[model samples]
Target: MVLAYLLSVIFTQPVVTMEAEAIQPVALRPVANLKAKDTPNDAGQSIDLSWELSPDSARVKRYEVYRAESAKGPFEKIVEFLVPTTAYTDADTLLRNKKDYYYRVDVVGELESRASSEIAGPVQAKPEWFNTNRIPVLVFAVVYGLLLILYIEFAKRDREMFVRRIAGLDAIDEAVGRSTEMGKPILFSFGIGYLTDVATLAALSILRRVARRAAEYETRILVPNYDPIVMTAAQETVKQAFSEAGRPDLYQEGDITFLTADQFGYAAGVNGIMLREKPGTVFLQGVFYAEALILAETAHSVGAIQIAGTNMATQLPFFIAACDYTLIGEELFAASAYLDRDPQLLGSLKSEDIAKLITVGLIVVVSVVGTIGAVLTSVSGESGILRSLTEFFNSGFERLVSFLTTS
Candidate 1:
């Protein structure tokens, strides 16, 4: 009886030990110190993370990094299954100021081990320095500013400023004159886009110039628009232009009409207007889509001198093929300044050119240096002064660029 009781106790002891072992939590250890720092290129935000190779991680698999807006967090995992590494960088961009962020790291092996550390303090980052990525932009800005001053000075002195004739613009007078001779109204379509679109603004600028010329010629100008806002704005702009030309009485609201908002519907309506009015000139300006070809084709069929301008690269080719003259991307904007002879606008154009020159120079330098570096590395099997020179030039230029942009 005594032997039987002792054997039973031994079996029970094993079961109790096994149950305790199963319920016990595994320990997690941190391999690196947790660090927090402000993120670059933003208003204000901080990132907190750590690196660690867990002893049990080989069996367990990955790690989880948890974050809480407050120190007491109902902590939630920000990163899950992170591979073991010596460092991690937090790159969250949208964190606001004064908002505390707490973090904790956990080693998750075959199963989840206990968190390595307690929840970190609620910390927030203040807005740091402005980014320097816009150095090239600043340089261009300065160059343009100087050019504008010079142009304005020349304008004050009544000095003749020579500008190259833009084919698209030079045809405007002829287009309006043709309509007058034919006794047909001119049709102008501000392409399908919002009033605030850059292309729409460009179209409006040109329209003002066109309206002034049309008013002086006593020619009827018809504008069909798809966007209600644009339609309203176009009416105002045309009226203003006619008024400025001392022919406000000639301005008619009926001349500026609103077509359907549908893309194809607008195109069809404009095409019909072209067919019925037999307008001698059709000005298609602003943003356009597939309807561009359809409108251009219809205008061409009517024997009208079609002038089109748009920034959309894809639509440019269609315009080039169909229209008599097309204003490519930046030209659309530049044309307005050119027509108005606005010093500020001209200045901006000059600045844009300077930026382009700088960009091209940098590209050429980088390409040459990179090719030389590759060839030297392959042939010499060792780095020399040539290699050092190449690296210095590339790195120095990059750093200078970065500083300018960041500043």
Candidate 2:
């Protein structure tokens, strides 16, 4: 009986040992050499994280990275199922200033272990002066500066800058001369528009020049306005122009008169003046609406030499048909610089011309290259040289355009 019992015990012991070995858990080593870097975006809101996978977990499915507010943390997983070779970027939009954060990485497999990497300290990146989006703006500034310099150089030589004669300006002296010959007052109407509008300001500038001439010729100028602010500015401008011409006494307050704030009402008053005064010269230089035709036709009937200038696209055709001379959109603004010969304004105009030239050149190049590229793409031919040349030129032209626009 004792021998039989010993045999059974030995067999049972071997069986127990085999079962325990089969159930033994795999040991997971801590991930090694963790690193963090500031994100390149310069938003001060992100960091890049990287680490080495443990040898034991090499065959494991994925890794997990954890973050915590403190070193001894109830760590929370920030990223999971991450490939061992891949680095992760963490963008913490909720990050608070001067706050501490800790990070650790763990290797996870079929059988997970408690081992993890040493916690990394909180890191903060300083804000940058420029953002990525500002690159275009910087490029533009450089191009603009170069263009401005070129314009200044050209202006300094007193070179005869050729500007196409604006029909409206050409009619100015003629209108005043006609008024002088006819011995009739010249009716000047600065349409009801705000001072801040570019068209209104252009009109004002033209008014000063016309008023000076009217003063010199001893021709009466009657200005009807629709805006209070415009009325005030027009009065001041006409008065100054008259004073500049040494005809201060000839400046009449009633001449730079305010009609009404209402557009139609002001138009009626202007029409009435056109009929009643029957002035030999009529100057319309401001923003006008449907009322433009009415005023122009009325002035035409009175046999006045009409000169109109405006930037309103809708009203341009009517003025063109009815007025003896009319200033177009950009031409109206150019006239101010032409008459005044302001260095800054003239420089700006020159820059604009350079910009236009660059734009046209780019358009032509793009059209030609695009056609070539399309033809090459359609044919299954080796277009390596053509492709490379086109790409190079396109990139260069784009950069040049960006520079000009920003500068």
The CA lDDT of each predicted structure is 0.78, 0.79
Off by over 4 Å in 2: 1-142, 342-348, 380-407
**138-210 in candidate 2: lDDT tens per residue?**
6656787789888877777675566666667877878888898999998888776788888888888888988
Q: For model 1, how does the per-residue alpha-carbon lDDT over 1-407 read when each residue is reduced to its tens digit?
A: 99999999988999999988877756656544555555555667656455556556555456667777877668877676655664555556666666778777776643355546556556676666666556566776776567667666655666655566688987888888988898877888888989879999989999998999999999999999999999999999999999999999999999798999999999999999999888888999999999999999999999988999999999999999999989888878877878888665665555556556766776676567556656655555247886676666567666555644453
Candidate 2: TM-score?
Answer: 0.60
The top-ranked prediction according to TM-score is: 1
State every prediction's TM-score relative to the real structure: 0.77, 0.60
lDDT (0-100) at residue 243 of candidate 1?
96
**lDDT for model 1:** 0.78
Ten-residue region with minimum lDDT total, candidate 2: 373-382
